[model samples]
Target chain A: MAEKSSELKLLSAWFSPMALRAKIALNIKGLEYENVEEDFNSKSHLLLRSNPVHKKVPVLIHGEKSICESSIIVQYIDEVWSNNNAPSILPQHAYDSAIARFWVSYIDEKLFVCAKNIQDAGKSDEEKKPHSEQLEEEMLVRLEEAFNKCSDKKPFFGGNNIGLIDIALGSFLPVLGLIEEINGRMVLVEDKFPGLINWAVNFAANPAVAGTFPEIDKLILFGKTLLKKMGYCL
Target chain B: MAEKSSELKLLSAWFSPMALRAKIALNIKGLEYENVEEDFNSKSHLLLRSNPVHKKVPVLIHGEKSICESSIIVQYIDEVWSNNNAPSILPQHAYDSAIARFWVSYIDEKLFVCAKNIQDAGKSDEEKKPHSEQLEEEMLVRLEEAFNKCSDKKPFFGGNNIGLIDIALGSFLPVLGLIEEINGRMVLVEDKFPGLINWAVNFAANPAVAGTFPEIDKLILFGKTLLKKMGYCL
Candidate 1:
């Protein structure tokens, strides 16, 4: 076993989905590391130095090297640990792996767009209603199409277990749920996307997810504050 | 040896960097394939059906499965042909692989932003001149910072080999170079970034790149026609 030292630390923010991905991956792999939470309002010099371009979290500092980008960090963890016993997150078959990666990339691109829309809506006033609704519909339509094409019999993305796809999608559920809660609108309605809703539930129920997820109340409170600061909340 | 007859087939567009990635990977690995060029303006039904969401080009159909997304396809190719004697594009060391992936991801995100700016500039009038210069400078600054920090001292992104980083960056060089050629300005001048310039030259000189690249003059003509159609050219 690799030496479990204080050297492996994760620099992250409390309510970041990207940060959660690294946390979940580490927990799933049974790796222990120190968590150094950053203040997003005023980032630290370490964070700036570690990831100068996109000085965002979560930044995984293993030994002296820093690994930014959540999805890439997860893949790195999988490679380093070789956790074959811990529910193979990535598919062994190359084609299946590609498929998993495609969905992950899609989530990175599409889901983030959706999240951005929700954030925009929260920050916008009455004049932006139509645009916000259109954005919401566009995001849902894409998700629905993806869900329809996804294998029907599979409990997870790849049929049997929670893999890379689950991790990618699962990371967003908290943010999605929080957005809906704060807005008092259901973007991912149960009837509209049963597969996605069920998947979300299953994902949330996972031990790793259940363990590391940010407290819902805390995030909701944070969202409310953010919206007010942005002059969205009345 | 793997069954040469059962090798994968790739569907690509003539002027697509994504397609070039798959093509280069195939050449690097010495894999035999049937290349069917798709018209981007009028995409084939097979391509559309294969990738409903994006409906984009550079779709690799390997036997029964279809893989879209250039980076994903390259990784898939690497995974499937793991036994091949070609140097593994992915670094063996975990930290090194992470670093390589970071650059790949950065290229996918930041470099594409610059490319989009250049493309948009080509489609704009004199009013957009400042925007184009600003975008060019932003791209150059980021590239310089990235290249400065790169671990490898070799001409390639990865040291002493053409790896994932090379493939990712190589795909974009044609478009970057063409943008400069069309604008009558050189963004990536040799004096400013000699390492990156050498890197581009080394990449262009690779047999895989030389064989598969589209004609520059033809591309410049096409780009001019495109700008004319978009009302940027008289």
Candidate 2:
């Protein structure tokens, strides 16, 4: 029955998938929240005050509480809006939820950081090639296994619903696509990983997540500007 | 009223604080489980098969299911044994649980790892000095903040009971002492972090965790042997 709150705000950066996870979670919860975009170089006072631990983006503020860590924020949103119309983001079953949580934890713990490093490696950056390739291959292998293990009949990871695992992976979709675009490689090839490719396609087109992603061209251009700003690319 | 499982096995290592988390969880739950210790130099078949993602120890096998990730396994234990007569390891309230999780996550994500690197950097290793020093100071500052924020009147992070946060940090007690012994610096000095030090002492003396830790001198010797084997020390 908790459809709305007096004050719900998200401190985020447009370019971050981590931030996108919070936005997408809010959108899915059917809850109205103000999204305040942040500049990394000159972080806002609210951002610094709210998130002293990591000083990171995607800090969710609910009433007087400030929740950092995007995954935790999503969980908070799900819990606070437990009576919302949407199906439980993390399934009701404990085991199933744990599995969903494991995959979500896997995103930042291993997958996303590796993917970012791999995507950031310059085309002619020979020194970084093998390291990036190794991580990418390992990531793909795990993704392929998870894809095969989850339902092929259903459109999402949790079967018949876009559950927590779906949101966790779905948030990273734009970045995955951006990496593929920048690196000019078919990271999610149909022949090699048909199940994953199918899942990605379904996820990208899904209403909850689809609108959240920027156009591939726009994402690529934005990525370039961001990287240039960081002095990682010229 | 289920007191135990017929087929509960813990795949773990003696040296790993991560492994100890699972052991401590099992103990606190009062559920009978077998401890199958693994040799780190040559991991057992079950360790590899059960945890293909990390291929690490502390994988809990219950009936036919295998649960990996120390914290995840602990969470699973708490859920599966929810009926057991022990108080919840993670706090019951959502915000409280989130705060507990935040601290637990901070241990591995920042504090423990930085402390390890700082402890491992040899006295003559001038190249590693500045980085280790910076990370150590930041970690200490953060620890002080978390300690002060989580508890003032109680000995544990959850205020009286050894909750998830306590277990997470308690497992690192021996290693912390060992780190100080090696580096010859009192990272947990009473004046600097009195709250954490108090919690650490109370945790070590508490029956729940006391039985879980090795003797201080024995642990020191073990740490030396392990570091020597790994070429981290002479």
Candidate 3:
């Protein structure tokens, strides 16, 4: 992917999965951007001005324009930077693109919500595990089926290379790891999700995704602090 | 939009806003399709098989393929049948498309959710209305702003044609009307949302969107039955 002339800036928080999706897509596209970090307690004026609706981070300022919402941002990246040399994040075919969009949405509305609920469960770990496990069983099993259906024996969700689904789910790895660490139980089990376990390994090792995840130890520490603030007795 | 060869079938509930979005897009595209009504009390096997992920209606079965989720289904219809003659629902430019998608998302998550909370609030009208009004002040006001920005002085959110945002927000008109009728209050106020008021009138009168809305009396009856089931007093 060749860089374009427009000055790209990402308003991001270091630990935010939403922001991470933007970062990974930018990296994959070979697009150079300024990372303008936001402090949540007091968000930056630019962020407030740029995203008046949600007033949230992961707002991508592309020259004069700003795009918000993580998945939409990723799609914008794929669309704008699509060139013959650049890898397509979304599939080129319309049906395939629809399927990819569906899964990406599932990641946003389902998988990520489950992970957040586990993180903020506030109950004793013993009291929380069953509910979390049930959520996982209902959600992740479908995801595994999605992987098989979408990947079509290829290595990545984008088939052969990283695509939209990869960026969507892969961004949550560090956070998922933190949840597992805190709960002292595996959220992504080897026995239950062998395909996903294998996919996760492949995803982390990919060059484009390698540095996109936050450092696990730091993430866990941050996670515990946030959980404590939310009334969890971690 | 010219008719395509693939046989299109829609599994739908009569009053679902989600199903209505798909129907509007299909109408705008001038694509003819079979409408299979579902008794949600016992959803059909085809629906169960077609959309195992959400297992909800508004699944578009094209020839041998089935696409679920209304927004995605709309997007798919736009992409697959995109011709020089067909009006593009999503904007052509990447930035414009992103902006459209963002507002469509707001319509789904914010506007529709607020409307639902107002409908499903089991408390007395006085008890429920203040909270609902506050939600409206926060949400519909932004939607009014969105209509102004996205529509850009045009008659519809799609600008010169009924685009994705128009379809997204327009689908809820009949349901919003139902809410207004049942509560004996105006959810979409003329003074507050003058632009949207005019836009809704334009949208309803458009030949493509005309007759797409379920009959108001039928919708009101169905809505009351649903609200009673949800423990709301008419």
Candidate 4:
């Protein structure tokens, strides 16, 4: 077994779901790491050097090597730690693993697009309202379809255990909630998607996720202020 | 070692790079399989039943189990046949494996977007000329950057050997070349991106890719007629 590293370091920013996913994955795996927060406005040279291609946060630096992309980082963590002591983030069975990965890919392709639109809506001028709303509606519909496909028996995506799907979806929940609160619109209404709502509740309740989630109030206030400045406020 | 099946089945379409990746992977691995051509317009019940969610192709139905998603299916092939007399597609080193996976993800996200735009342009009407041209330009720029990033290396994305990155990118070359030829545009010019051009040429020279690649002349003619009907062609 490769000796567990005590010198794992994370380059991250507060309120970034991508970074939060990496943090949560590390915590779940019982890996100890120093968290280095990077300013989005004035990104650190380390972050830039670590991920020159994307220069995005949620870069996991282990000793000498750095891994970028949230999902990629999560997979790296799972592969490095071997997922023995920690909960298995990937499905045990190969087929189930494929399914989990499929959903994760779907989340990246579909759900994230909607989330980006909503974020952009709050960041764009009044003229972008039509485009933003169109994107939001499209995303919500897709989310509804995705939620419908889930069986209530599985609290998490992989039947009773939080796996890759949960992490993928959970990472976006904080931002979704913040966006809704700022916009005064409930995108993921509990009444509309009870199962998804319950899933979110249970996911957020997980110690690994709940412990490190960003401050919701801070995110909401920041989002609202940004929206107002962009002339897209309620 | 698991016995290799006498007859393998590939569920795929003509224009899908996702399907093409699987085809190339199987060929590189030197596995002989029965090709099951699928019509995208009216998908066969088998394709739908096998992959209900996406209902898309490149679904490799080995003996009993079915695998969907080009990247996942490729990994599945590499894993199941690890001990067999197949060419090793993935890198042995974990970091290299991660890098290979990263490029695969990049192809799916960035390269696929460009391919989609080019396809959409060829399928649109005359009024959509501006949209098509803009998409073409965007794809060219993105492809240029992608080529530049990989140009420092050898003919392939993984240095000398044709690895997963080559498989991923090669699958799209036929379609990209077809689009460029039909549109009378030089999206992937030799002088502009010689490395990428060389990579594509080497990929096409591969018996696996070259053998299974769709005929560009036929595809170009088909695209022209389709675009003309859609009012896109002059």
Per-model CA lDDT versus the true structure: 0.76, 0.76, 0.84, 0.72
Model 4: per-residue Cα lDDT over B1-234, one tens digit each: 434544478998775667888988887777878789997557899899888767878898887777889998887777767667766777766666777787777677766664555556544556445544654466445555655554456667756666777788778777677667756687677776666777788778877677777777766876657644654321
Model 3 lDDT tens row, B99-141:
9999888887777776766677465777667657765687778
Among all windows of 10 consecutive residues in model 1 chain A, the one with the lowest summed lDDT is: A225-234
Q: Which pairs clash inside model 1?
A: none
Better of 2 and 3 by lDDT: 3
Tens digits of per-residue lDDT for model 2 on B30-132? 7778889887678898888888888877888988888888888888888878877887888877777778787788887876766566556454557546645
Task: Give chain B TM-scores in order.
Answer: 0.88, 0.88, 0.91, 0.80
Alpha-carbon TM-score of each model against the true structure: 0.89, 0.92, 0.94, 0.81
Candidate 2 lDDT for residue B147: 71
Candidate 4 backbone collisions, by pair: B125-B231, B125-B232, B126-B231
Which residue pairs clash within candidate 2?
Answer: none
Clashes of 2: 0
Off by over 4 Å in 2: A1-6, A121-124, A231-234, B1-5, B121-124, B131-136, B231-234
lDDT for A148 (candidate 3): 86
Candidate 3: the clashing residue pairs are none
DockQ measured for candidate 1: 0.81
Which residue segments of model 3 deviate by more than 4 Å? A1-6, A124-127, A230-234, B1-6, B121-127, B230-234
DockQ, each predicted model: 0.81, 0.60, 0.89, 0.43
Candidate 3 chain A least-lDDT 10 residues: A225-234
Which sections of candidate 1 miss by over 4 Å? A1-5, A121-154, A158-160, A227-234, B1-7, B121-138, B148-151, B227-234
Clash statistics: count for each candidate: 0, 0, 0, 3
Off by over 4 Å in 4: A1-6, A122-155, A182-194, A227-234, B1-8, B63-65, B118-155, B182-194, B227-234
| Candidate number with the higher DockQ (1 or 4) | 1
lDDT of 1 by residue, A1-234 (tens): 433758689998777888888988887786789899987668899999999878888899988789999988898888877754665667778887888888888888876765665566444656445545654676556655665566455666745666787787777877877777856787777777777777777778877778677788888887668755754321
Model 2 gets an lDDT of 0.76
